[model samples]
Target: MATHHKADQPTLRSLTKRQWIRIASVVAVVGLVVAGGAATRSIYSHANAAPTAEPTAYSISDAHAASRGNARDALEGEPTYVNVTINGKTRTVLGTNFTDVKSVLDAGDITLESGDTVEPSLKTKVDESTTITISRAGAKMETEESKIPFNTVKKETSSLPKGTEKVETEGQEGILEKTNLVERSGDKIISSNTFASWVKKAPVEKVILVGTAEQQPQTTTDTSNNSSSSNSNANNNAQSASNNVGTTAPVGEMQQWAHDYLLANGGTEADFTATVYIISHESGWSVSATNPGSGAYGLPQALPGSKMASHGADWATNYQTQLKWFWDYCKSRYGSVQGAYSFWQANHWY
Candidate 1:
């Protein structure tokens, strides 16, 4: 076997002084580097970590000031309040900075229907306290059926005796279909106009025959006539004349008076014709005529019968006085008889 010799391991004491000094310097440098690295990590952790100390509190006065400023700004941005009435119901709404009435209503989601009306115009400006009123109106077409009255015609016959009348034909009412345009506003009818009308049935006119024949007295020969008989016949004739005058005084007097007065007051035959037409419908040319329903009297149908007293004290019995007052009224109010007739034709009254 080869000679086994034990080699000695190097020890610190066996190492040279210069090698030991170099080893010691290396250990010192490593220690210094580890300590500096630990110190730098501590500083970086302190700089980045969240604060743990109790937070400082602001003064109550400073906090209230900031809160008040925010509240003021919010209040200034708010809109103004206004009252709005639509279809009889009132409600509150914000104006939302709108300037005109239309804009304000639009902001409230209010829509207007056809023919609706606004108290203030849509283009009118709105204020803070302005009250908007809306009138709801609508128009629609409606159809209705009505009756038309028939007319009566008169004919005179000399063959029949006086005061005798005969009906030649019967009268009948006619049917008419009328179309109306109806306008309404808030439960009230604003207007109803007849847009079209059609006659469904024609009216039958009544024909009447009047008697005008007079009876003649029988005549005898005068061979037996004596003075006493002659005197008695004259007395009888005078009594008959007086009776005729008393009976004829009230009959046909008003029509005759109206005719005479109209001719004297710068009125022509045309005026007399219109006057007769009106009087025929009003009071039938009777001075003592009185309307039971309206309390109207006289040929002109004056209301209360006292209106005719303005003419004369004898207006109740005298047809001439009533006619004079009627003529003056017609001239001053209607300018002419024809004008009055025109109005009567439209409204059924003058």
Candidate 2:
């Protein structure tokens, strides 16, 4: 009843412009914070940290090239600087503007020729430190190895009573060298001849020489009872000299030949040490060197004792005959007795 009296509520109106402005301001601040956060994240991504790498351990100490600084680079478009490797380690360089291969080389003070081939051509873009092999072009003749030729070396021997030459050693030759090779390219050989010398094809034949193969007959007697044995030997030797001119020599005479030849040449006390080896090898100082199987005889291993007779009629027992042959062999075959001795030092049979 009393409620309707004089009091009436005012009609409600819409939000004010100031209130809408305040709400818009809050939304703008939120949006700004979100955008700022995104921008910060992008900056962090662009600022990527570089990874760590190992350091090289190398040193240089010299006058000409050793004094130069160590330089290396991780190249991209162009190599900034040249790289020098030392002691299996790498270093770094900076501040260079080399563009092409030739330019880079030029900066490094390298020169090239027309026929020379570079690993990377001059027109190519330079990226990293590259190697270039410079080979000079020229014509030349050379020697090289080639295949051995087929050969058949036949032999005949009178030593065998069968009267037939037999092969001693069947040998296959091997190539030694190729010489005067013709060049086709710059300094390379296109074709060449095999200037090879064939190996000695002396057959190692088992010869059956026709001679006294049996041991020389000997009679053992008491030294006290043998009064004229030496004289008997002398007479027998003299008789042998008169008849068998090809194969008879006194042992004492052979020794004398060796001694005389050594003295006449350059035999010295030091050489005597070496001579001992020679004397021990060839007939044990016996001038009558004889290989009953091969029919080699005489002081210097003549093919047959008969051949020594060419030296003189007394070639069989004469010291001078043996000395001449031995001296000639030493001088012609070997430069000197000392040279022969050096060979003997290495080869016990020399």
Candidate 3:
């Protein structure tokens, strides 16, 4: 009977609906307070946080001082590539932060020579990527005088044997020079060339005695005896000396043929040395001198070789024919041996 009374006093199922609403309201209030506190704490934390870092400053200038500092920093900090022109060639290299323009070139293995010039000096610093150019040195020139071989002249006199002559004086020589040699520093023969007829002189011709004449008294008897004796021995002696004189080295048939050819072809002793000089240089008294490089043949080294035949069909063996060709060539080209020799000196060919 007693247990039944206590159950009736505190039974939840028996509690009123208004009482349940009050409990639910209290629980909602507590939850809102806790949530507001959490939101406030998050806002405070965000406001008090530290800020991020900023970027470094960079500058470029033409001035040496600022550019130097900037260039140094750039090189030390990071690798930047730059372009440089050296020795007429373009080169690219990585510029260090502390690297000046000169040092950069050095690192690139660009060395300056005596005549070489660079746009930027060693003290110049580059703040940014840059291009440096180097100009190579040009050729050097030199002048010199050189003695050259000239023509040989021959002369005949009554006091000497037939076909004999002597070189009165040595042939004249001249000088030639070349200019502008291209080479590196301390190099020789950079460029070379011959100067034009700087000076010219007439070459002296050779002379000699060919024969002698005998003078006789005006008496009839003496004159008759002298004339008879002269014919008898002179004829035989002349015949014997003919073969010998023709083959003689300096005063041989060649010299005689040259003399006859020149006199007949409007040439004089004054121009003799000039003519001989050219022929000697070309053929050296050899009828068979031929140019293997250009196919020039004969004493004159005629390009076609057949051109000499125009003087005479016997140009191959007849000195007169060769001399004729030479005379014509001289008149048409140089007017004389001296003129021709002058041209040869400058050009090495005429």
Candidate 4:
């Protein structure tokens, strides 16, 4: 168990220095080959590299301008639609850059004239749901013709007898023109107002004349005589004819005028006394004498007062007209004034 063993070791070789020199030479050669390979791979990688791009330049303003142009183009592509009412006529239109109602109307080629109005002001912004209205409010003068009534007037005159009337002038209607201001909205009527009215033709008034005259009372006289009075009447007629030339009248001024009137009408101076006697009995030379019993009127004591109008309208008031009528009555009834006087002498009235 107690054995001690000697450990020894030692070896010696021949030619060791020459061998080490050879191995070092071979290592150096290998290192050179590896370095050449790495250089070739770096050249290939440099040839395969891609080229870099150049940088572009622009200002903020230019960029903004380009953006706005694009925005406008987009807006033009999509137009806003709106309805327009011009004078109550409605239509639809498409408008680009539609900023206000007026712009939309202008795009639709609508024009606004003077006195034209629009609802939803021209400055109002246009939208899809917006509706524009335009009204033509031109002032126009309208005229119409109308009629005017004439007035009737009356006047009093003494030339005609009482209770008599006559037309002095004819009446004519007049013409009038009335003007109005009319307003219309399209085909519908809105308002009308009268502005001016004037007479086109003046009216003519009707004139009537009325009479006013007084009537007198009538009385009778005695003319009774015998049949031999015919010779006396003839003598009386000759005496009256001779007295007609005298300046101093035997009777009063009215009898003188009656004598002249009868002479002017158709009676001779011989009929003057007989006429005077007949008139003195009938009406006492009263021009307006009226018979109360027989309703006879005037100096002639006509059966009806209106019958005297055949001779003249003034028969009731004119002594000459009554005398002429009396002369004709005597001629027609008794053949002559002398005959009438004789009848009156027998009857008291002829």
Candidate 5:
């Protein structure tokens, strides 16, 4: 029983048309689902992948290089050179980036004291090759006391004996005050000037009085015998009379001449009084008057006696010549006889 039957093959005509369309649609739908699943898996994998960074205009390397360059420039910066003068001395200093005059001085360790001065001003800007000046000033006041000498004046008086002098008033010194302005540089003084001066005390003048009068002659008699006594008496009386007459004559003549001369020469009664006073004290109105100590001569007591020679050759003997010289002397030295008398009153001499 080996029978070989042929297997039946299926054909399109074995299904209805509606059934075939339904089967074809089911197949298309399954294929579309499979393709959509594959596309979705690819998109999900791309979204999950790591991203790459974008390039920038400036990099970290460039920033680091710029920072290093700035540091190098700061180290290589040039220093500012400045000249500074303090008092009278000048010196050079080096500074870096100093803004003002005060900062520049601070860089040099210079200090400013009260009353100190700066040429460019402390707030002024400083630069390379800038010059600055400083000055120091000081002032001090001091008081000093000093003495002023007094002057001595002399006068004549006929009330006392000749060649005698008496101090009428004592001399006194005076005081003065002075104020000065001083300029200095360091320890040296440049200049000093007197600003003010005043007298603290007024001086007192000295007064002195001189004496003038003629001395009387003395008479001596011998008592050895009566006859000798009589003769000595007569001779002594005659000599006394003669001496009295002679002494009076010269004085009267001198007084008359002085009065006439002074009155005729624009002189007043006061001047005549002063002239008589001085002449009486100086020479006792003697034409031949001479100073034993100084060789002074004449009524005016002309020193060296030769000074009167200019007036007259008979200055040693003539009363009128001595009087004329005396007038000239009074005019030249004291301006007037009254002035000479005032001087003589203070100094006991004219």
Candidate 6:
């Protein structure tokens, strides 16, 4: 009994190892629960904390400028995803390493054709918000038709009375066909120019006759008895010319006019008769008569009609003008109206 250890030391040593382990485990569990609760409280506190006041708002113009700057910054930044529209369909382009719109199009496997156009030029830098558009060719060659104006030709002649004017041929407009290279968008024409041109129908030139005939001296009727008989006798002598002349004076205004005109101009009654016959067969004395098949015109029915213009520009409408032309042609070609009539009787044309 005298050799015993200290009491405290013995007490500790008496406790079992299992018992000590159990106590330590209990303490550890309690500590974990308490720590978990404290962590949750800390999180709740931070969530409820008051936020700091926001910075003052910028002006509208300043805000716009800032937005623009941001856009510019984004465009110059790293590779981004962009949108590309060819025709009307849209698709996203993965601009992985693209720097500009052109590069973006290349990445999208898109191509441009002749006269094709793009919005936001190919040289512009691309960004996530950038959209590239491709439009089809806008220019094409087309045929166009329009009117061509006719020309007018004037000639001086003695067929009409002095100081008179007459239109021998009416003017006609012609067709002008052209090849036009036109630039258009949809239905709108932006620009155009004629590349080639041709006349579909040649224009008919208008011929005008201006008279140059000298005025005849007017005879004053002498109410005096002595001159009245003289004047009557003189008038009879003028048209009849000679009792020996074989042809009779024609009746009617136009016919009598022809008769007097021929005789006064050094023509025979036979010449007047030949003229009436040829003119009657050819045109019935109508100044505007036209031959559809041969393109002949006027009283003389001259082919191409323009030949009548040599005698008078009024050849198309004036009977006197056409008659004069006919007389001139007869004299030049057949020696006289009688000769033309002789030829016409056999050939049926003169």
Candidate number of the best lDDT = 6
lDDT of 2 by residue, 1-350 (tens): 56553345432345577878988999999999999999999988777756433222111110122100122221223324433221222222222465666665454323454554555556776544543333334423454444332223222222233444344445343332223324366565564322111111211212222222234457676666566886686576445432221211112444444545566766653343333334334433334433322223344433333344556877656656855655455556567545555664454333
lDDT of 2 at 55: 21
2 versus 4: better lDDT goes to: 4
Residue pairs with backbone atoms closer than 3 Å in model 6 (clashes): none
TM-score, cand. 6 vs. native: 0.30
Per-residue accuracy of model 3 over 1-350 as CA lDDT, tens digit each: 55454655847777789988988999999999999999999999888888432111111101111211222232344545556654433434443453677776654434566766777777787744456766666633343444434433334333344455544455454332222223535655543322111212222323322443344345546566677776867775555433221211223456557766666767665455455555554544545433222223455544334456788887656666766776676667777655765665454445
Candidate that scores best on TM-score: 6
Query: What is the TM-score of each predicted model, taking all chains together?
Result: 0.29, 0.25, 0.29, 0.29, 0.29, 0.30
- lDDT string for model 4 (75-127, tens) is 33454556666444454444357899888766554566667788899999877
What are the candidates' C-alpha RMSDs? 39.0, 29.8, 35.5, 54.1, 47.6, 37.4
TM-score, candidate number 4: 0.29
Estimate, for each residue in 255-310, the C-alpha lDDT of model 1 and write its tens digit.
55665666686766557656755555554444654332222456665533445667
Candidate 1: stretches off by over 4 Å: 1-253
Candidate 2, residue 49: Cα displacement in angstroms equals 82
Candidate 2 Cα outliers beyond 4 Å, as residue runs:
1-261, 264-266, 306-310
Q: Native-vs-model 4 lDDT?
A: 0.55
Assess candidate 3 and give its lDDT. 0.48
lDDT of 5 by residue, 211-293 (tens): 55556575576535667876875576444432221111113556767767777978665566566656655554545443322
For residue 70, model 5's alpha carbon misses the true position, in angstroms, by 97
